[model samples]
Target: MNQIKKWISENIVVLFFCMLCIAAYTIAGQNPYVVASDLINRVMRNSIMVLALIIPILTGMGLNFGIVVGAMSAQAALIFVTHWRLTGVAGIAAALVMCTAVSVLCGYLLGRLFNRTRGQEMITGMIAGYFGQGIYLLIFLVLLGTVIPFWDDQLSISTGIGVKDTLNLQEGMKGALDAAYKLPLSTVCIIGFAIFTVYTGYRLWKAGDEEQKAGRRGRIVRWAGLGILLAALLVIPVTSAVIRRCSIPVITLIFILLVSLLCQFVMNTKLGQDFRSVGNDIHIAESAGINVNRIRIIATIFSTVLASWGQFAFLQNMGTFSTYTAQQNVGTFSIAALLVGGASIDRANVKQAFIGVVLFQLLFLLAPAAGTKIFNDSQVGEYFRTIISNGVIAVALVLHAMHKAQENAKAAAEAEV
Candidate 1:
């Protein structure tokens, strides 16, 4: 085959998978179309979390494995909000604030750590994630009672070392966020993410102009997007009714969108360009007068804030927090999801993260059923899903290293040649 045809043939696997999925959905159920809606919702819910990785990826710092640190901040904020009896959008707002504060601090620290350990950012980030988890656990489990004030017994452990096995947030607010009685307006925010994706694509199409131009200014887009986001934030309740309503998750999503867009806008500014440049090539950026270390610090902080927002969304959706294990493994899995979405080691877009979350989650949600169809045993499916999710991360990391190796080899060979 010619090169063009060969390229198409090489991508045949994706086409085949798409066709296979359609076929299986049609064959497996009486309501394949109904199933499609659930799939879409799952995609919408998970995509923005994936969207959070874009900045770090743009800066060539690799996946924000330190996003776990941000996730910890979010979970901590969530716990406090719940303990304080904050409900509805107010609770979510407060949680975001708390999460952002924690994320900024965590990001600042992580940036310093990364700066000290430069080339091993991924490993430094991974270790930072663990370090944050320990700190997070201490706050949630041990410190909340003795040092911090905890009024609720449910939130406080019997031994007072940590929270209980599971802290049901609704016992305080009673499904204030997830109540089906509310409107499903949050769906609009999900739609907003889609709209943002479309806008990003449009921007990509206009990249040549953008690159050559001074700056986007982005005033009209900014004001208009903010106005729409605020409207959706207000309508989250009314919109929740159209679908099975979940207010908190929707609120969390809108918050995340606003934050991510804010981050995107930041990336597009002069400072933002400098930030990207530093990530692209630190030596060049530094020579050009960019403060590479500061940019790295700022980038880490940005990643933390977004990840914290993501964790807030995740928790608000579940309306329950697993005290011990909930926040620990976030970075490993989330970074994996981004990788699965076709993001490379040094670059990721918001859309890729969204696609990865949806695709990864579709498999997560359906693998048991899909497995039952194939293996007639869902337990087997469950086990396999665990393996697949972890395997995706492991493979991505390995692929990242291999790709880096190839780049170094090619550069060296070219120099020699």
Candidate 2:
């Protein structure tokens, strides 16, 4: 009972959204294949950006809205690569290298800005995003052809004064990553299961006798569940058909997997523990000889770099770049998705990031259909999406404030005792 209540309290947002998804799915009446395909595509596009927010949250910096700057860095790289006529894998490799360079510089400077702002990191990040956008506009809009001396017939304006508002990436740059490789979804699932089974077995093998005994029941239940899932994946014809119909973007999915694993791996390292310490209480962490500001800066740098890579993946998958507008909402949507996954302002993880992306994207996919079904207009769904993305953030902030207040009051009472 107590445990159940605690679980409910922690996961209330996730549960609420899950219920909403079910309701929307029922109303939408969409085919499973279409939904699954769209959801997978969206997951591949947005998961890395969502994951980018984790390090900052762990190190006590809020959502790092400055990720827009990183996205901008990627766009700049993409533009240069396209201009250079680099094609296929080589183009992607060049763009990534360029993106990383820019992201590192931007991240380092942004981290310094964050260190100065301290408690106001979130708002500072938002301002930094706007500030960076201004600089981006100045360079791309004003200086590109005038001061920078760059001109391409396809990429530039009619007068060659600036880049075009929309840049077509048909020059072997589009789908460069996503189209590189593909794998059957069923095979992906089998591989996933195999990896998990090995990991579980390794954990059991490494456990002490007492620890193993204590967790035997839980381990048995988990193994049973995995066995059933694997069996269904192999034996159930309907499940097998659905899985077979889906094709995973092998290269893109591999990047997402690497990022997910990196996030988990980082959290277990000594630096990651320092991040947690700083997040929990900076004063205490400082007293313990931790460099709180340095930790925060490192966290910001990691987030910004990841966001750059994420935006690179996003544009490659989409096959076009909107130039000025593509990066504007990167931070907002990513933050909202994280919040919807049951992460608080100060706490987040890889699992929450994955769960958030799936749920958030599902709702996004369903909203228009459900709206059309009930209201005879798809626009209502767009409005609902806007509300959901912003509203979730507002609600989470309020809840976090309330939680903090309660904690403070409890501490006060203990002090009195």
Candidate 2 off by > 4 Å: 233-239, 398-417
Worst 10 residues of 1 by lDDT: 9-18
- TM-score, each model? 0.75, 0.94
Candidate 1 per-residue C-alpha lDDT over 260-339 given as tens digits, one digit per residue, 9 for 90 to 100: 66866887798779877987888999899888888888887877777877776667666677876887667766876787
Write one digit per residue (lDDT tens) for candidate 2, span 199-304: 7788777778896878866876897798798788768886677778988899899899999999999999999999999999999999999988788888888998
> Residue 402 lDDT in model 1?
66
Cα-based lDDT for every prediction: 0.68, 0.88
In candidate 1 the C-alpha lDDT for residue 45 amounts to 47
**Model 1: lDDT of residue 80:** 74
Score candidate 2 by lDDT: 0.88
Query: Which lDDT value does model 1 have at 172?
Result: 38
* Model 1 per-residue lDDT at 91: 76
